[model samples]
Structure formats: C-alpha cells, structure tokens
Target chain A: MSSNSSFPKNEISIIRGKCLVLPGNDIDTDRIIPARFLKCVSFTNLGGQVFADDRSELKGAHPFDQKQNYGASILVVNDNFGCGSSREHAPQALMRWGIRALIGQSFAEIFYSNCLSLGIPCATGSEHLIKDLQKTIEADKSQVWELNLKHENIKSSENTFNLTLETGPLKMLLTGKWDATSQLISQKKNIEKTKKSIPYLSNFDITN
Target chain B: MSKGTLYDKVWDIHRVADLPGGSAQLFIGLHLIHEVTSPQAFAALEEKNLPVICPERTVATVDHIVPTISQKRPFNDPLAEEMLSTLETNCAKHKIKLFGIGSGSQGIVHVIAPELGLTQPGMTIACGDSHTSTHGAFGAIAFGIGTSQVRDVLASQSLAMNKLKVRRIWFDGQLKSGVYAKDLILHVIRSLGVKGGVGYAYEFAGPAIKKLSMEERMTICNMAIEGGARCGYINPDQTTYNYIQGLPHAPNFEDWTKAINWWQTLASDTSAIFDDEVTFDASQIAPTVTWGITPAQGIGINECIPTSESLETNERLLAEEAFSYMDLKPGKLISGIPVDVCFIGSCTNGRLSDLRAAAAVAQGRHVANGIKAFVVPGSERVARAAEKEGIDRIFLEAGFEWREPGCSMCLAMNPDKLIGRQISASSSNRNFKGRQGSAHGRTLLMSPAMVAAAAIEGKVTDVRKMLGSIK
Candidate 1:
C-alpha cells in the first residue's frame, strides 16, 4: 500500500513509466487554477479548472487538455516549486488535477504543507538528478519511470536516486499517523497535569 | 558569556513555562485577526461558549475576499459579503477593534500594524494568516496559527507552542542601486531555499539590514515564510521608532521616551548566541523572478529555464511540466519570454510604495499589445494614497486597471482570475500553479517594477533597463 506523505518524502509512488516533465520556476497558483473557479468553497469541484490559464493559453493543445493523461499523477518541476503566496489552493488545484506526487528541487513551505495534509507526496533531489530525469523523459516519454514510494527511490534506466525526508512530518504521514493533531488533542490530560506545575498557562484554562 | 540574540531574548521573555512535550507556553502580547480565517475560529469560540478574554489585545480587519473594485454593500460575491458581515458582527460582539474598509486605519493586516505602531519591539504577535510574520520586522516574535489556535487566542490571549531555534542571517555590505528590499528578500530565499528557515526564527542582521527603511524591513520580513522561517526580524532600531513615532496607536510623548528606551534595550547584544548562522552578500542579489511553481524556483532575470539535466530526479518531472506549461524550452533566456498579464497587489507588495514604483514605470508607456495588467492595493488607504499621487491614472493610462483595495488576484478570492494558462507577471506573493486563480495559469513573481517592465514588454524583461526611462 502506498503511504500518503506531504513533506518531501523518500517514499515515492513508482510510476513504472516515463512521465512528461515541465520546467518552469515559480509556476504560481494562478496557472494551476484560474481565479474564476476559486469562488467555489470546495476544493473537490475545482478539478476542471486545474491549469485554467495555461490550458486556455495553449488553445486546446496543452497536455492538460488532452485525454491521454487524464489520471496521470506525477509532476516533475524546477526549484522553488510552489513559490509565491501562502495559498493552499495551489496544491489543492494540482491534487485535483490528479497530480498525486510532485518532483522538484524545492517547494514553498505552505504549498508543501498543504500537499502533505492532502496525502500528496512531494520529493526533492539534486538539480543534476532532476535534469537527468527530465532529459530521459523528454527523449522518451514512453519509457516508464519508477518512483518507489516505500523505498525512497526514483529508478530510471540511467540512474537511481535516493532522497531524504524530514522525520517529524514523515512519521505523521507514513502510517496514517494523521494522529499528530490527535496527539496534541490527547495531551489535554497532560496539559491539565502540567497546569498545576505552571500556574500561568492553567490560569486561562488553556486546555481545549 | 553570551550576548542574547533578539530571538533568544524575546523567546526567554515570553516563555511562560516549558511543558513536558518540549513546547513552551509562550505568552502572546498581541494577536491580530482578519475575516478570512476568523469566522470559523469565532464559531469555535461560540461552540465553546467562550468570551474573548482580551479584546483589547487583538485587532481585526477584512482583506481577503473583499473586492478590490467597488467594495460597496453586498459584495458581488455572496460569500464575501457574508464574511464581511460576520467579521463585522464578530468584532462588534467581541469588542475587538475592527478596521473595516474606508477606515483610514484599515489596511493590510501587516501594513496597518506598523503604520499605526500597534506592532512594537519585543511583542509576540500571532495572526491566522501566514504573512503575519511580517510584523516580526520590528524584532517581535510572530507566528501564523490555525483556526483552533485562533480560538485559543480569543479565549485566553495566549497560545501553547514550542520555542523555535534562532538562525542569524547576516547580510554584509550595502545594496547596490536599483536593488530594493524585495530583491534582497528574493535573494535570501533563493540562496537559503524555501525550507532553510524551518524550525528557526531568522534574525536578519548585519550592516545591510540596519540601513533599510522600516518599509523595506517589512518587505524583508514579509517573505520570511518563503525562507521557511516562522518569522524574520531585525532588532527594533531608530528606523523602527521613527516610523512609529506619531501613529495613532503609538505611545504618546511621555510614554514615547519610556518606549524608546525599552525598545533600545531589546536589541540583540553584540555577543548574541544563535542556534545557527548564515551569511549572504548584498551585492550578489539581482532582480529575481519565479519561473516555475514555487517561490524558491527562481532565476536571475537573464537566466534560462532549467533543463532536466540540471535538476534532481524528483525535480525532473516538474521541470518538464514547467517547460511545457510555460511553453519555454530549456536554456532559453527568461528575460524575453512573453507574458500575457501583469498583476500587482497582495500583502506581499500592494502598499503605496509598491504602487508608486510600478506606476513610475507605467506612467508614459502602455502595457504591451496583448497583455492584461492591473494594480490592486493591499488596503483602501493604500489605494487612496496611490490615487492622491495620481499613480492610479498612470496605471490606467498605461493599460492597467486601477482596482480598489483588497487582496485581489493574489489568491483569486474574488473576480480577478486567469482564464486558461495565461502567463502572468505578478508582483503579489506566491507563484504556485493556479495560485492566481487559474489551475494552469502561469504566474511569475517579481518586484512591482519588474512586473511593470514585463507589462511593457509583454514578457519577462529586466526592470533596470527601463528604470531611467520610466523616471
């Protein structure tokens, strides 16, 4: 079973095929989903608008408009991926576009967190590795690339790459330990117990 | 034997108790809120039947979802109207100060804080919005919190949190001509990467930082989140005191002297201890732009789109996607890439100064043939100030729409949006895919001047080239 992790994770979804890669830095949220569709309060229904501006600019020739990659999920990108404002919508739009995982050298703090919360895995590697994977895929889109989520590896014919994950967030996502918040919640007893020790925090009934 | 750093001093002063879980029950001196994320928190308060324990310690405003154009009654978006009404009602009910549209004091949460002197040295501030860290520019410890925590603040005026390690980022040398605080921050984020500041509060120090104007400091701290820092701050100095001197919320004459002395004492000692330290050269920074999905994914104006070969394995796929979506080939210079729209406004760069900078460039020129561009002020006051200087006319004449104040197109909570993959040069923060309100809408983040240059060229062009011509 594939684990859902949002923080840059070594465990990646192994897509046993070459995926189309895009190369732009600072590809902002607007290009992922246009503002016109943001009026909807729900992230689930904004799927069609993913890459709204980019799709329109391509005049139906964009890959997002094509039916071939409808459910294709992997997205490889440049450094500072998801930079700009702290809107969680950027990742929400991408997740809806069926982008299950993002491969990039870096990610915006907010965007990366949002992706993690949504079970979307983002991985980071060196610039050289990113470029090699891109060239290999650009030369042969038909070749399947493997992004092994459990193994923390990206396997291509030419090279295999290992990645690092921040321990705190990784543990939370790997075992459905979406329980960190719950742990915080359960700390109510501990909080109360400590209230006696620290009269200031307890004076206000800080416990939830 | 250690001279405490600003972070260390502030953290120690605010630390109420160190709990068993290693988190500190830091005493919050001030908390700010806005309509977007507070409704739910207020509702949570209602559910708990809690009263605002310290209404005087909190401030509220409406920025997000407020239409920049015609912020009239019953906003065009029904939900926005509801949010406004709810915030208005909530503030009234809680006795918390609410800065509504048209109030002279009503501005971006971050902007109003400094301008009114509500943010002061050594205070710990928290807001529901991430950019709340903007207040840290004053040497205050600030954090952006979640909704439940918002409820906690409303109920107790304090939050339970862990102390963060402090990283001292020292910028040496003076910034060169044409370089502004925006460029400096972009440079910092680019060098540190977005996550470099994680688990730390960045104390921006050294000669270069000390010389910056308060507004410039705000801009530097504004993007602290980009560097993955919980907050970025400079010790409050004469510049900070001068900026806050006569504001409505500032300490009056008698209190002013006392406040200044207190503020002076808050500066980090010469021998401050820091968990970590990073250094950068001021001269090395250049006019930067985000070429891909993230703020960290940036390149110098003349740099080329990264090819897969230059990136890591995980980045390869995104690079390929960026190349295709942005319709740029690898190694192609980003400077001449055609842009379809130019947007300026957001908490990031929607102040009066940002508007003037962009307007100066747009004054005698028109937006390029096929480009769509506009300026949205961060607040009503900002819009009015821009109009007072006729910056609005310059933008209008230059083919950019002059919208009212609010967080527009920046996150597309309102009508402004990219229709379909329209490449834009935006001055607002964040360039994540679809961040500007369209799923595939391409966004390039740059300083307001850079956005102006791109608007004129219909592509990403260097602002320095046209700086002289614009003036």
Candidate 2:
C-alpha cells in the first residue's frame, strides 16, 4: 500500500479490482483521512494513514484492516462519501492505499474533483444498484470486478451494472485529459487576455 | 443554464478558454493559499518544473497549522513548524505575498481576505480550503479546490472547471433575535441533507439574506461546503461596499465609485433564472445545533433527535451510525447534553462579529465548573479589534481563555485539541468525529453565542434563554 504507482498520465477508462464495501452514508473526508494526520508537508505517507481514526477505533475489524478485502482497489460506499473538507489528502490516501476508482451513492464536490485529478474515477449509481453491488462484493469478496468509464458500466464475470458520471468528467477520464494543468497552461494567450479583462486583476484599470 | 445570476456572470467573465473536455478554463481572479494544502501543490509544481504563472494573484497565509496558544518564531510542534516553513519557503520562492504570522493581516485565509478587502464582487476566487466560500459574502463566485488544482492554478492562473448550476436559496423575513447565520445554515443543512447542494452554486438571496451583516453573510456562506455546495454567495449591496471601502486591498478612492458600479451590475437581475430555487423562512429557524458527525444531522435546541423509524428509509442508516458515533440514544433531546470542552473559533465563526456576539453572552457569566472553554479570534486584526473593545477582557473575566488567532480546535491540526472522547460545544463548522483532534472526540456545532451559553452551563444550552436581545 505504501508503494507509489508511477502515475500513468494517460487514459484511465478502465479500472479493475475486487470491490471493497464500506457501508453507511456521508462518510466524510475526515473519516477517510482525519484532520490530525493532515499536518504533513507531503502526502507520501498518507496511504498508511487513510482511515487512521476509523481503523484504529474499530481495532482491526474495519474493512481496510480485514484480510478478505486485500487488493480491493475499487471502493463501494454509500451516499455522500468523502463529504467534508477540501483536503486532496483523502483521495490521495485512498489512491495510495490501492483504490483506483469509487462507486458511491454520491460524493462531495471538492472531494470528487480531487479524486478526478488523481485519476480516481468516482462513478455514481442508483441506490438499489449500488447496494446490490456492495452486497454482491460482500457475499463474494474474491470476485474480480472491472469498471469501464468508456462504456459506463461495471462488470464482474457473472454480473454487469450501470453507473453514471458527468459527461465532461467522463471525457476527461477517457481522453486522459484528467491531468488538466497542461491543458490550462497551453492556453497561455487566453489566460493573459482574460486576466487583463478582469477589473480587479488590474486594479480596476482597463486602459493600462 | 442559470441566466443573469452572479455565478453565471462571474463564470462567463472569467472564462479563458473552452477546454476540450467541455470544461472551461476560468481565470482565478484571486488565488488564496494556506499552509496545509499548498505545500503538496508547490511540491508538484517543482516536480513538474513549472513556474507560478500569476504569483501576484496568489496570497498565502498560515492558519490551519499555527498554534492558537503561541506565536513563537518556530512552532513548538516539529511537524507544524516544518509545514509552516515549507509554506514560507515556497511563498518566498514564488514571490507571492506571504501574510505570515504577525503580519497584522495574518489569520484564517477566509477571514483575512475579506477583512482586507482582497475579496471583491464579480471575481472568481479559488482556494485549497473548502471554506473559501466565505469570500462569497461580497458577491464573488468562489470555490474550494484540491492540491492538484492548486498546482494547476499556480501553473496557469486558471482551472478547467465545469460551470456549476445555480440554486437561489431565497430566505423570507428576518432572522429572529436569538438566531444567527450559523443557525440558519445548520438548519438548512439539516433540512436539505448534507448532499443537497452538490454540483450547484448556492445563491443566498431574498430579504432575510439582505438584512444580514456582511460578516453574518460570510458565516452562512462559509458552511456551504458542509451542505455539499462548493460555493455559496450573496450578491453585493451597499453593506458590502461599506465593509470593503477602507480596507487595505480595497479599490482606491479614485476607483471606489467604479468598483461599486461594477459590483452593482454583477448582482442577479430581477428576471434571473436559476437551475433550482429553495426558500426558507428566517423566523422559523432556531438556535440549531448538530447532534451527529455530519453538519446536516442537526436539531433545533428544543427539538429531540429523531428515532430511526421516524426518518426516511434513506436517512436511517446514517441516523443509526450517528447515534452510535455520538454515543447518544434515539429520541434524546439535543439540549442539556453535557460538554467537556467549548471552542469558539474557525473560518466559519471566528470573525470579530462572532466574538462580539459570544462576548456579549459572557459579559457577566462564568463558565461552568471543570469546563475547558476558550476563544480564538479568526485573525490578528480581529484579535486586535476585540482587544480594543475589551471583548478579550470580558471573556477572560468570565473564565474563557482568550487566545491568539488561528484555526484552533476546528480541524485541530495544531496542538489545541480535545483529550479523548471529550465532546465540545464548538462554534466551528464541521462536527465530524476526530475533527477537534481526539479520535473519538465529539463536537456539537452551534452559533458562537450558543457555544458561549453552553460554556456557562457545561452543557448544550439554548442561547435564546440567556439572550437579553443583544441584536
């Protein structure tokens, strides 16, 4: 879990893993990575610290601590998963802890964007659909599953489920343009032009 | 699809390019940075060999990690010191204005930005902290970003962002005397659920919103993230102009009228159309308090926590989880719950107005026996102002430890934290487990005045009972 995967700065349309189920709703970023652990200059050691508070409180009974869920890189969670704070540390921790994608009832906006930037596709599904998927994984922890953002579906050998994501983000994941700094930087001319047009940016001077 | 709303106008105004992914590259008019989230972003920029394209637009501050009890040269906590030093080194290297500790303007980024008038209307502001929405009190469209986006902003001065749908939250009437903006926001979250504002920029409008002071408006917008709205804003008015008029970064006298005219035009037109509209009656809101980890799980001071069977099927699981995590029984009254600690600070409610409201409550009252109660101003300016008004003296006399300015006990990144399972009556925003430092620590979110009242009682007490109509 501590190994840094060479960030494949390319299309992440497909994510394969054994689904790990974490039940309950509004599972905030604080629970994902508690604020106490966020006192670092780097996110390198965050993998071992993800769910530090919850896992410690559960005393080895938490899903992340369970042996059956090992190698589970696709997390199955309930509603409002990753709901508090804008700490990218939450998604970075999950990514470093072996999660490649997330399927939840919903996700907080900032947390979702953080995951997208990290190339972790957060797919959403209907309540019934997500619960069914979570139960399926719980009943058979070893079953391998694959989420295809290109086709917008999650599939195991025996089952396939539909998931929903915004088209704009879908395009980003499919086009490997999720890493957006280059794209933004590439529009240097427009950036300057836009900055010049903003009144406050130029101290309200439009002429100069 | 929203038309003529501030969010729409600001988004269009800042659009630099139509990104291929259907997202727009929008220029960040004001880029705010803080110690906790910017370090990694700076590291990424160095790793990528990129230069900060618009260093002038970015303003740095040290808040999330600084100790509220001490403002020494190097922080006592080694890791906290390292984090702050990393920010100092990065800001120095980038030539961004670092409002380091003791830079009279240093405080919570959200607090200082607005206080110094760096936050203005018709701007698209972005910061790495979720409470960045606090700047929206000036009618600016602001949002919280992650470290990667922070890096993106550093490299390009912009973000590839999808324009958010606008939801005008119309408030009718005025907030009752005892109720404040914090109560209103908590009540809204409680009614709407924590995820209600996802993908939507909340437009806090109508008569109730208009009547609030700019600082009060900031408190309401500050917790927009708590309800899943990355951005929440109030349109600028004369109140906004008055607040920014004399501040350090406000437009100069020559540009004041021009700035006001431009700000006036940015408000939502009378014929504006929104993606959705939700209305609330301000008079209906009470001194709301959270009884659960998520901000949405709140009840009016007089209300009892609902049993699982009483909630909707979708809300039941979280309700059960809340009951256990908070160690409270179903149908228990939220008021009268004993608290071991009381904290009054955070980006959400640490402004001078918040302290004044709390100080008004603590004027002649003493904190309950054995309660560890403290007050931390949002910024040095707020601290100085409170001291000038003898508000700090009032708190100290009432047995509340008046401390320095920082985001203390809110996220608990510094040493100011709770000891084991201690439930705090906090004026901070989030009430999440371990949020105030201890792994099992509990937090009951309320108005600062309510936190003051709770400090007096060593339990969750309704501020309305103690209020002699301060407003």
TM-score for chain B considered on its own, for each of the candidates: 0.96, 0.99
The CA lDDT of each predicted structure is 0.72, 0.90
Candidate achieving the largest lDDT: 2
What is the per-residue lDDT of model 1 for residues B1-471, given as tens digits with 9 covering 90 to 100? 223877777666665554433345565778898876677678867876868867877899877777766878888778788778888999999999999887876767887777777888778888877787888888888867645566667776655564677888899998876667888888888778667786678889989999988777888888888777767889998889888888887776756776776677778888778888889888777788878766767888868878889887755766677676666678878888888888987777888888888888888999999888888887766777778888888998889988877777877777787778798888876766666666667888899989998999888888887985323
Model 2 agreement with the true structure over B172-274: per-residue lDDT tens digits: 9999888999999999999887899998999999999999999999999999888899999999999999999999989999998878878888899999999
In candidate 1, position B409 carries an lDDT of: 80
Worst 10 residues of 2 chain B by lDDT: B462-471
Candidate 1's docking class is incorrect
Interface RMSD of 1: 7.1
Q: Please report the candidate that would top DockQ against the real structure.
A: 2
Candidate 2 error regions (>4 Å): A3-5, A203-208, B469-471
A1-208 in candidate 1: lDDT tens per residue? 1113333333333445335587766555445655555444334565667776677667887766654444456788876666444445567666665677778877755566556655566787888888877776667555556776567777777767775544444444565533123334334444344333321222322212
- Report the number of the highest-TM-score candidate: 2
For candidate 1, give the lDDT.
Answer: 0.72
